[model samples]
Target: MRRLAPLILWALACSAAAAADVSGRVSTAADGVNVVPLAEGSVIEVVLTTSGGEQVRTFAARDGAFALAGVPAGRHVVSAYNSRFVFPEVHVDVTASGVQAAALVFNGAPIPASPLVIRPAGVAQYYEARKAVDVVGFIKTPYGLMIAFSVFAMVVMPMMKVDPEEYREAMSSLRGGDGGGAVEQSGGGGRSGGGGARSGGGMQPTGAGAQRRQIRDR
Candidate 1:
């Protein structure tokens, strides 16, 4: 039993060292080379998916560092997530020796010299920004100017006061004179009896001329 005790102890030690710990940092790149850690109040979630579809999750600390302890020896994919930035998945291989992390893959292209430092490919925009209305710019447009003129006429025309009689007189004067002037000229010609009497005599053919012609024929 004493000889077998050393063998059992060695087996337990080997089993304990079989599982390794995976550690990495979450960072953001401004120019695609140098990386900076995430903000202090930011929450970053790191996920490790094993080859057998098992997942191990952990949150990054304030300094953007995270660790998953006792990960089984196998191949796994590491991904980091945040609300404002997009990150790429990293491939990692775990053995009894140590953890080996692959370079980050962004947009299907692997970044060179990139190790466990996870950086964002781009910023995530959830909503569009609201723009202010430009009053001057709108008024400069043809449609906007037309709308403004119509509104001005609507507002100002109601406030103006004008007498109906005065409006009618002014309109008649502007139209060359009062409408009664034409009627008055016709009445004056009738009263004068010069042109009116000649026109009446020419229109009546069965009067004195017709009677004289009948007497001569007899």
Candidate 2:
């Protein structure tokens, strides 16, 4: 029995280290008011990612309030979603002794939940129905597609190659100038005048006097 004393203390320490609690209220904006509590059945899911792996739990709010106990201590992302709304993910750190609190506010209404069904189905029909429902769900929503496309464009568009000549022509058209006409004319005149004058030893721009004149002109 004396040998068991050390094991008992280690067990108690592990239990304490794994203990955590989270609580929150779910609310929505009301007319002329800051916020109004949501109805019961709003679902809150907390996802904990630790060195051990990821753990998930779901809790339903009662009268807009919810509490989840026995969560493992670490950092977690809490996401609240329901038939009417979706809240942004909230980040919280869970300590052994304190409760992590959250206030979730949702702006836009989400797709309504399907009605409950109790009818039995064959194996093939069950899979077919589930696949159809999932496809419909993906098609009926625009947010996921929009976010994916936006991210894809931001990442891939920069890596795509654009023809320099095409870009120059487009800019010239926008500026009411011919593609290479303006560039050729201006560059030729500037080079000839600057190069000839400098080579003829008439106030070469390599000296301090030319710099003073340029600064005064600016």
Candidate 3:
């Protein structure tokens, strides 16, 4: 149960397809450490949002593997967050084509929720991304796996948008990169993920969610 979210997110994130191959090695934006590939029993998460504020997506990381699938082609906000480690928000764009080699970095400091205005979505992206990279960067040492897998991903939200247990469970298995989870439709027209985890299209995107609020006033 606890590990499900990351495992699912990783499987889904790696599953994203595009007009071209939507695949590349992951690394840290700051230092550029190549993130290890996803493995079994590893949990990771990411966040994604659109510029138009239309779609938002979340992903899971398992065994150091993760993915963001079923996203609309355009420039969008891709943030990195985690409940355990500290990182900053990075804005990236996907083309009508797709996303290629992107690195989500851990800023190594606590990022307050006030900035994003959305807690879990932003925080989770960092945690997941940090964890994913750390897992792969492990260099076997006399001590053990040379690298420390656990970075400092702290959860700071008080009244979370989702349940505490879920948030924690999601957080533990969570980390965010622009917050995009592959969407699996209940029924099928062009539905993907078939009984599998899908992208985060259904969830109101942070940018779009904010936009809707503005529209109502106008």
The per-prediction CA RMSD against the true structure, in angstroms, equals: 13.2, 30.3, 50.7
- Please give the RMSD of candidate 1 to the true structure: 13.2
Model 3 spans > 4 angstroms off = 1-43, 100-218
Better of 2 and 3 by TM-score: 2
Tens-place lDDT digits, model 1, residues 1-218:
99999999998888778978777777767457766555557799999998889899999887677888878888778898987788878777787655754655444444332236776778877989998999999999999999999998999776576788888888988987756798899889778898778889887886878889999999
The CA lDDT of each predicted structure is 0.78, 0.55, 0.43
**TM-scores for candidates 1 onward, in order:** 0.47, 0.35, 0.29
Candidate with top TM-score is 1
Model 1 scores a TM of 0.47
Higher-ranked by TM-score: 1 or 3: 1
Per-residue lDDT for 1-218 in model 2, tens only? 99999999999889877786665554444332454444464443434344356665555544445566676776655555554444455555566764443222233322211210011111112233333347556745897688778988999886676788988878879987675787899999999998897787864545878789889999
How far is 109's C-alpha from truth in model 1 (Å)? 5.1
Indicate the residue-level lDDT of 90 in model 1.
78
Q: Candidate 3 at 97: error in angstroms?
A: 2.8
The best candidate in terms of lDDT? 1
Candidate 3 lDDT over 148-204, as tens digits, reads 333212233333346777776677556653243333233453555532444455444
